[model samples]
Target chain A: MGGHELSVQPDAKLGLHKNWFNKLTSAWASGLGAVTHKELADHLGGKRLLILLGLVAVTGLSAVYVAASTIRESAMEAVETGFVFLLLFSTSGGSLPSFLSFLGFLGPLLGLALGFDSVNGEQTRGTLSRILSQPIHRDSVINGKFLAALCAVSLALVALTLLISGLGIELIGIPPSSEEILRVVCFALLTIVYVAFWLSVSIMFSIVFRQAATSALAGMATWLFFTVFATLLAGLVADAVVPLPSEPTALELMRHQRIEMALSRLSPTTLYYEATSTLLSPHTRALGPISVEQLEGAIPGPLPLSQSLLLIWPDVAGLVAATLLCFAASYVLFMRQEIRAI
Target chain B: MNQGNVVIRTRDLVKRYGSFVAVDRLNLEIYEGETFGLLGPNGAGKTTTILMLLGLTEPSEGSVQVVGLDPTRDPLGVKKVVGYLPDRVGFYEDLTGKENLLYTAALNGIPRKQAEERVNELLERVGLAEVADRKAGGYSRGMLQRLGLADALVKKPRIVILDEPTLGIDPEGVRQMLQFITQLSKEERVTVLLASHLLHQVQQVCDRVGIFVRGKIVALGCVEELSSQLFKDEPYVLEVRAQPTTEELIRNLKGITGVDAVEQAGDTLLLHCMSDARGEVAKVIYQSGTSLLHLAVRGRSLDEIYRRYFLTAEEQTHRRAG
Candidate 1:
């Protein structure tokens, strides 16, 4: 039987003799579209999205309200600054941080919640094998899922930003200038990228851990470590690297500060804070330690929007690169995985 | 079985996981529009073979051709026409059963209008129309299996592979699933490859069965052909039920030329014979002035054939080791 001659029959039903490249391209397109549509519906209609959005909305609105009231009390001083609209995001009042700070703290939680179970949940449900058996490239599953979650998060962030801007305009009685609006749009876009980085990290965790609960915990652990402990750890490392005494000279002090700054930037939370602070405060001229000699001839006015963006370009690029790296890690792991129902 | 063109062929296929050989030197062929069963015990490499056939996993050696296209090279093309129902099939619990089927239809690139109509018709065909609107989470295991069958057929695929479709279902559910598979192949003219560990269940629906043991097929043919081949050197056990059994009757039964031994238990007689001797034994019973109540031959069951092959394979391994 093994040595019997066998004839290969051409598949007439599927018309396989036509241009192979065209067939493959069309198959990939349809598969990706179908997966993206299905995952988008799942994300938008899920209760998880609703709960996370509500948490962000309530906290964000309260922070904005506090900042708005504080700005109104010092309305003349803020108006004189010529960027009262930006003040609504950067101003802090009576024990509450500004809206930008609140977003920086809470945005990762939203990302972690959306992606911590994206891959492992399907495996446990026994749906992974069924979905993969479809006529699609294996990468389409992960790509479509990431794309859908990003869309949902983008929608939530945009809506929240617009709502706060509307409330600020009504309460502070100052419409944002064109530059302020541009800065705010940049802020919104930067926030999305930061959240997307966390989303990719959580997705990577989901792929590495078999259990959904374990993956969720891993994501939260990473978030907590970066958010709370990273800065303190950086400070300890800097002190160890460049010991500073009470009687140290000015040069030594600058050296310690620079080391601390460099170490702290390794954390994504720190990067997000530095980037958003520069974008929101037009009057900000420097992000790092500067000598009196370098500042002697500098003008005492707000920097242009382009200069501010330049000051934070490295931070923005760092966030985008981190997002892509995490996504790429998860993509490689998922593709190599043996997808058996277990 | 239909003598149509061979739709699936594998030559010298093998799979290895580290040092463990999962499938070894497998050679198989399934003609178009035939229901073939890959029967084996658990861990007999049936699922591995099925995965290789579907292009879900690549073989370590040799090659596989499905519908004349190499699975490793053109998996998407093969997948376009081959529908697979995995063991313990799962659905998105949050979605309704109808929605799950529609999702599969969409993935296969069926138009929305056409997919909806086909999904509805399949839901009706699989007896899931009443609960089509309910979330799959609320469905029973049997209902899920039926929904899986409906999902596999949503694209009107030419070949369908079902791995343990009856694994966890109740007796009645298994019977219904077997009936559905048989009807599917007969009515739709679709080729079916069913991988299962349950021998009698596969025997009910499959036209040809390949008894797999230890990553190799020991027998491959129709049921009768396999039975005849395996039992050529073994004697057939003829069980006879009669009233008023006597020594003379036993003596006379053993006197038959093909009968090798005869034993009497209560009102029944067990006769081990080289060939079928039911007619001669009946004539002897009538001659002895005793009434024959029942007669049955017991070596032709698939369960027996599977057990025989398993024992032989185990003995061969032990001999080689020794």
Candidate 2:
């Protein structure tokens, strides 16, 4: 059969008769949609992702359980009971950090893990060049991956948030107010933005590094620096820049603390923590050190949701800017990169 | 320069990385419906040229057009019509062969129904229908090559650019692949741009070949023309073996008009001619006292031509440095 097929002459070559305009049909949406679907499926089904999900679920519910028990025991005012849901996510309980804290600390790692190898893995598999050779524009490949990872993070965030809310209702026997739910949703969105920043950074590393393991390590190193060392480094810089007297005046001490806080906020983890704390805890009025004089003028009441959003708007904007900058850098690098694999 | 038959044209097509120029001012015209081979050694910039042609890599300084569309300006259009098979073809390990094809088809915007039909047909065409449902990771190198070929053809591209398609395949697989490539050009009318360091592989199928050296086209023409060019003033060797003595026959053979020289070695006589002068020499041998037993012509081989051209290129480089 093989010999017979070999003897069979191929028909005359395809003529130059294809409608050139038909070739111009842009499949950007379809291509992006197809790639996103595939990647999302891979992420969701991945064993590593499952393990992370299980860990978050166990840790989150345990904290929620402890916070709910405390809220039930201290339930003296009905009007203020709705605020207990916020405490469930914001305050650490029973020797464990709050669910929001866990997310702020560990969420970026998930994003980084998902995306660190997105581009280079395809290259290593030898599919990056092939997919780029397809009819879709080069932009779609990276955009699809970013969008898919963001979608996965967003899904996990929403599911975890709802689970906490459901547990709060069951454990405390009090449903959260409409405002609390709104804040949780906004917090969920903020967490997605925070995670996406790391995703873009990881993808940039992937494009810069050929090996998947190398990119993953780089991402982990950055995450560790921001999470563990950024604050200590910020304090050192602050103290070195603004030396405190042995018996410092109030103004000097305030200046030293302000510098430390400002420098520490440079880390995405700090930004996310501040933003989520403000969003999840309405009683929290300020992110920086408050002067005693200013506290004397403040009212002993919960601020409105709008006020909380306004307070953390800069942090939200910063997270967005960082995400876009990382994404833009990766976009330019990928576009300018030579297609031939090393 | 936008002639209808000129399917692909590259003028001053140079690609540089830092100080290294991978492709230097290459000018080429590949006509429509012709299987043109870009023949060269490793690092000769054949892959870079192909990348520029596909618009996957921008040329530092040059221009390229494929199917009348500037690949740089209209890469999607060029890519739509041009199928590319990289030297190291890769597929998603977990996806089935058919799934991989379908994914490529989707990216090309082929409707799902049409993509399914086309995928099955290509799978069968590549003799991989039985294993279409198997994961690509389990496939052998030859199977993967065929799968890559099918992937390239999934969109029914007018031009197929194969970069070292037979690079790592077994000898039998190489022969089959070469045959498949020829069939693609002959039967399907797909204009093929097969780039390879293997001179013999391209020589077996290419209608025209461009030999590259140090990022420059050192030679370009059909196989016969290249051979003649390399052996320009050299004579064709014709050996005549006869059972009897040939002193008079050698003199008679020497009298032929185009015969350059004649020498006798025992029962065999060597005739050097500027061109083919076998007919006249045969008639003269019949008239001589000896009967003809065997007559053989030893023409310049492509291997010799390839070696001479590369050596000349090396010498030119050395001379310039000196």
Candidate 3:
């Protein structure tokens, strides 16, 4: 008895939209699904551990936050301030392993962190070579890992967001408007993109480093630099790059411009916060008046929301572009690196 | 077992790492339904060759074709048909053995229902049926090897490449491993390429063995044939008790018809003579009245054969040095 044969075209290496395509796609889905389930199961601890743990964590966090907020003003402030705190923590933990919340940079750190060691982990585990032994494309492993990582990140972040939101509605006395709901969804997705950036970085690291811990740490380092240290350095660079006069009047204006520009380039969080302010708060503007109208009630000038969005487009594009470039670099390296390495 | 001739053929295949030639220029062929043993020492390029065959690495020079397809150029196609097991099989230690098998089955596009059934059968076959639900991290080395065997066979691949499969296995595990491999070949009749440093194990299981030395294959043939060529020529041995009369009689009889040489081996006197002159050699010993203890034919175990070849290579180096 000779072995089984899958009907494959000699030339079409990638998937096609044929019956074979369906089989291959389903195969990929099942494989990735199993991987996702496995990770989720490991995380929660059993058959439906993901849901079980997710709900438990959700109920616990929500109940605790609601209970705590009622007792302390600081706890109430932590709801929105928690994002900033998380941002700060992630920036700190982004480059190294941590016990709690992963240095607040879990979002962007995840993109690379989730996958940097993806292929190598599988390779060392012997599954990568074994999986390749099947009739699937080497490309499928890459895609499947990326997708599985994506799924893992999505599930985790959504659980976090929903748990928080469920608490916000029940005890915080604010049902998010439909528009706010949309924004929350976008925020969730943005968190995924942030994580994906790290996931890609992690995947590349995985290709470069055979050890999973090394890849994860490297990705965390990248996240740390990008979110925290990069901002600090960019601030210094922005000041150095732009010249200011010593004269008092010109120095003041130059200082103001320098600080604004530096702040703009320093962190994606600052940029995201700026953008979110414009989107969430109707009165905020990109430029113009910083002072109130006089007692005479003379008209005061201020920039519009559209101008604010426009003013921040470059920063938005820069972060998104860097994220994309990192992912692309990882993809190329993984595609090229020989699967056999000691 | 050769159903359709050679399924894989390689000529002058060489792989180098920096200045070291991990795999020297070599030629080889693997036929269908035959378990070909690529036997070698550590760092002898057995794994490198297997990696190239599976398209995990690109060859520096030479050509390799598997199932009439270039492995590098047609890796995806070849991968779809072949199954591989590396030395360190790191599965999702967190995932159950059954889940690991199921994931592999899914990767091969095996239907869910069919896949589960196969997983159950494989789990039972590998003696992990009782603990199929346990996480792989907790598995013993033997259990993992068995699970790996299950993973490889889940797809029922036509070509199976197992690198150091029996390494780190206990005696019972080794028996079971060999038996499972034999079963695959016997039942599924799949072609297997077993690569290892275990020469004796290869000799016991493989029909043909290729002895790889310093990246190149120095010898290739049926095990029996190689053994016959190396050991059959020097088969006769003369033995005598520790006695002055025996020694003198041995020396005196040396010039007799067909005795090649006489030497002392511990308490015994060894006489090398033609196989046809065994009677004459014994008769000469009898006439000396020196009681002969034992006259035994020197038989070569696979270990002895391997040692002889390795020693010959070493001796050539010493000869050159001198």
Candidate 4:
């Protein structure tokens, strides 16, 4: 802020932020916040930040639609709330929403969308070499950019989540109690991981493709191929190619298992969302509708949230590790690539 | 400040692109408090050499040390003391000139107060104070060069390396740049390294020069010393009033001898003599029968010396082949 020539401006044109009074006023206006103000400025300076806000708007709109349409409570008030939860689990909480849909699914896509143009845009504008030539460490640029993008996607999620809460209050005519708010926060935390999952994926693509457009395309295509129609197509392909034997054998089971594993487990979205549902829901161990047969069989009670979390902790750790590994790989690649001005 | 010690030292520095050697084995040392010029024509490896020195490109062989730090192992260390302007300075087009300077200064660890004062001084010195807050995208080439020069000066680095600083500048801009460079070298005592194609480009301001050809330095020394040494008892061109035979030349001599070659124009005889013999040869011509109608002696220019002495090795190969 200091090295820019202030004499060029007639002293009046400089931003208020630099003025002492403005600093006091800015501090007053902002009051006190947990996040540093300087960090907030950097978070907003990201290139694709506006587009990411748009993504959040889409997420909020989708949440509003699902919240509005799925409230058919008056028809079956006796069991409608459970029906609603079941409907939410089956629709908004499942593979389509987590895989191809916006809330859980677009979380990772938004991460990739945040960083696909990181290095190449700088190279195109011819700042890469000059930036590297400075005294700053090479690690800072990549790390700073990723942190900025993460902040942006996180902000987007917060706004969307808040908007969803606001809409639910208006439409359902009830604000959630403190406990439900806490549950929402947990969901939001899970969504951040989901965002980080894709952010890492996008960042890895950014490092590989030195051109911005190519990197962006690679990111989008990877997201699409992994999340959309991957499992469904895998089953069809396996059925088409692997002929049914007279009797089911280990070979047939192995072929089907291989196909399902490759298509369903390969994507980060699928893995993370599956883990999220397992960890969040308390009634998952119960049958679809507990009937007399379940009572005869003596099914155990629903597990505690802690035990549920413990059961899926390995899966969560695996997915989180995969996200971080992708990010680390990108860091190494970008650090090694020549930062030429051209 | 090791008064006469070298600020930059490279040992047989070589940069290659697979089989093609962009810069061959080049060994050079630039001393402290001196304005050094790397003079070369196109495809002459000047850019490649600078890139290698700045650690922007890896060298195929040899080593580079700037201010006692290896550029490859200690690039941040080297960059801390060196301010470089690339051949075509490509700045962030979106940022204002002031923002760019501040960002760079902050990155270099300059405090806000000092960076501001230095930026003001640098902008005024480079004659770009008026457009400091304007976006650099719309700047003219000369203005951009001036801004780039100011940006480099923001750090007030000990070593300033400018590649083709005046390449696209007009005559006035070139004059301003050269004068600024000269002032910085003399007043600030900064080590200046100017890389350019035109030999005459920085001749007026430069203290010494390295003439590069085919990735090797054909010549390296102070301009004055090199000029004096090359022309020392070497050769000179003298024009006389009329063509003369051996008898007239000997008789018209004023205690002068050892004129090696003589040629005739329509009405003048050109005398090629030692650098030291100019006074005597002119006196001899005036005193004798030549009548001293027209006595003119032209010293060789550095441009001529570069063109005549440092022909690219490829040209020699071509000549031999032909």
Task: List DockQ for all candidates.
Answer: 0.56, 0.55, 0.53, 0.25
Real A-B contacts recovered, model 2? 0.90
User: For model 1, how does the per-residue alpha-carbon lDDT over A15-94 read when each residue is reduced to its tens digit?
Assistant: 45455766656755768778888988998999998998898888888888999899888878888888899988888888
| lDDT for residue A85 in candidate 4, whole number 0-100 | 33
Best by lDDT: 1
Q: Put down candidate 2 lDDT per residue, A156-267, tens digits, no spaces.
A: 8788888888988887776778898899889989988998999999999999999999999999999999999999999999999899989999989899999999998899
Residue-wise lDDT of candidate 4 within A1-342, one digit each (tens)? 565775446455455445876655443332111112322454577455677667656655665556445554442651333323322322342122421145655665677766776777777766666666676666666766666667777777777768766755666555454544554666677777777877877878867777888988888887777677666777777676676677867667667666665566666666666666654454465312234655796655546656666666765776778878988998898777754324
Q: Which stretches of candidate 3 lie over 4 Å from their true place?
A: A1-113, A172-174, A239-267, A287-315, B1-4, B228-262, B267-269, B276-296, B311-322
Error of 1 at A11 (Å): 36
Model 2 chain B: ten consecutive residues of lowest lDDT: B1-10
Q: Please state the interface RMSD for every predicted structure, separated by commas.
A: 1.1, 1.2, 2.8, 7.8
Error of 1 at B198 (Å): 0.5
Q: Which stretches of candidate 4 lie over 4 Å from their true place?
A: A1-47, A72-100, A177-179, A240-258, A276-282, A285-304, A311-315, A339-342, B1-3, B55-61, B224-299, B309-312, B315-322
Chain A TM-score values, per prediction:
0.91, 0.89, 0.63, 0.71
Candidate 2, superposed: residue stretches over 4 Å from native: A1-27, A70-82, B1-4, B237-299
Clash pairs, model 4 backbone: B254-B284
* RMSD each, Å: 6.3, 9.3, 7.3, 9.9
lDDT of 4 at A190: 70
What's the TM-score of every candidate structure? Answer: 0.94, 0.88, 0.77, 0.78
True lDDT of residue A158, candidate 1: 96
Best-fitting candidate, scored by DockQ: 1
Q: Candidate 4, residue B170: CA error in Å?
A: 3.2
